[model samples]
Target: MRKIERSRMMPIALYRYNLALPLAPFQWNMSQNHDFIQSAQRTISLERDSVDALLPRIGADFTLACELLLNCKGRVVVVGMGKSGHIGRKIAATLASTGTPSFFVHPAEASHGDMGMITKDDLVLALSNSGSTAEIVTLLPLIKRLGITLVSMTGNPESPLAKAAAVNLDASVEHEACSLNLAPTSSTTVSLVLGDALAIALLEARGFTAEDFAFSHPGGALGRRLLLKVENVMHVGEELPQVSPGTSLSGALLEMTRKGLGMTIILGDDGRLAGVFTDGDLRRTLDKGLDVRQVTIDQVMTVHGKTVRPDMLAAEALKIMDDHKINVLVVVDGNDRPVGVLHVHDLTRAGVI
Candidate 1:
């Protein structure tokens, strides 16, 4: 056998193997967690800066855009391409909810038959960051031919889309949050903020009310709070917990348990609201070593219980509960007689919480 030097032979083989192989990506000397955090911070900072840049540009063009939409006989027909299209949809939704009738149509889809959605009475609000997006540009002539007012939001004011628009709302941003400065990061955020600004400005100009907003968002929690009346959430009929002042504390407890409200409204002999007896009163009474069977509810009940009207908003009832740090409210009519009993649980269950 030939005398073999294993270490020298292995070194030659290893050097040749290393020369043929590429470096592993995971072996790169960098902290991934640190990079992630740094990237997040940089993106947020860039986007925030872009949003700040929009504040100063709320000028005459913005006013003209508002005016055109406000005067339009038909809905606002919003058009955009790509990322601009996504932001346009949200803008339309916000406008629609805030009392200004609006809807979005994709520029590409508009070219392919969706253009019929736009009419002479409609006001077209087009979004194109570059102001030269071919799809949106193609619809400009059709929009103008139909005598529809065109409002353009873009970073490039000198571009064709801006030049063609009746009003150009400049949405130019300093830079993008993307490391390559090409992705729609800061620009999209600025566009969204500007759209919200427009919606809110028009909302205020039209004197939009919470009740109006509630009507638009009927299935939402805000609607339940604004539209659901006190009577709607209050326990009425036999579900209401009521007792006479002459009733014993033990009797009130039975009423509370029976009604599942943790409290009972106390009525005077005249049938008016005399007071309220609650589980908290039971605790205090117990702490005082009072006999539940011996004491009348009038002795242990809370005098001048918080009350609400049947017509009051459940939100108002919630506010009263929060202000008083109490969980129950007695609904009374003009005669001061208990019409219903409202519990915090009822408000919670009704989605008014």
Candidate 2:
């Protein structure tokens, strides 16, 4: 059976209940896989256009907002209610990780006591779909009184929150993707895009590079690819399964079994990288002659083997494998010595693939 079939059935009420009818066979489950993506892509493209339209309007005030955030002594403080609150959290997180010190503050929580999280040295961004969310609008006066610069993102530019803002980036959208036109959809996408534009643009202006981004997201895919050194995850010491280049093919096979990596690194004279022998190589070797005792690793090892530096990112290693369409590689040092080997499976296990 295909992977799509193994998915649990969708709720009858949430979708058309007639399992016997109506869809391409492969789409029996996960109808949303392509359908929803197509729908969402429409909304994403629309929002992308909205942000693109915004570029021409990057006036003195927009520059001013950027300058204010750039000069802030503290983090960028984001606040909102409802769906906007959820989007606010993502924006805050993106900003914080991309070299801007930032975090989300729920307006409701702030009204009670969390208002203390905002300070005069901070730049505050407020989000509201209606420009009049009571929880958010109610707290606006206090934020203004605290002497922090206020930036509001709302679909309704004429609303109170926009009126209160020092700079209001128009996030207005024509309509939501929701059937009733009531739920947040396109509007939230535009808001999120705006927040991302701000964060990344500010990140660039501050000279924040990929290394800076890696520091904030060491656990993320790109961060792992760019920041994780081979030493941090490579097998070493007694865990290594390696053999000298002259070892018999059977001996190399034994090393592969003991190491459980489906392959073994072959070292050269003076302990340097020489070549590699894999299970695949053994199979090819057997095709010529089944006598392992008569063969040596040098007779079958791959002389021009793929290799990576110990200091390279795990992500880069995955890319090297993918670009070359290979399955395994040896980790080498500055002197071209095999320190370890990485397989496609290793990247999967390390969450780098």
Kindly list the per-residue Cα lDDT of model 2 for residues 1-353, writing each as its tens digit: 22233225654443443453356557345543467777778777766766666667667766777887888898899998889999999999988888889999988999999998888898898999789999988888888888888988887879999999998877887667665778887788878888888888898999998888788877778777778766677777777788886798878888889889888888887889778877777788889876899788888888848899888887888788889878888888888887777778877877776
Backbone collision count in every prediction?
0, 1
- lDDT per residue for candidate 1 within 134-156, as digits (tens), equals 99988878887888889999999
lDDT of every model, 2 decimals: 0.89, 0.81
For residue 330, what is the lDDT in candidate 2? Answer: 88
Candidate 2: C-alpha lDDT: 0.81
Candidate achieving the largest TM-score = 1
RMSD value for candidate 2 = 11.9
TM-score (C-alpha) between model 1 and the true structure:
0.80
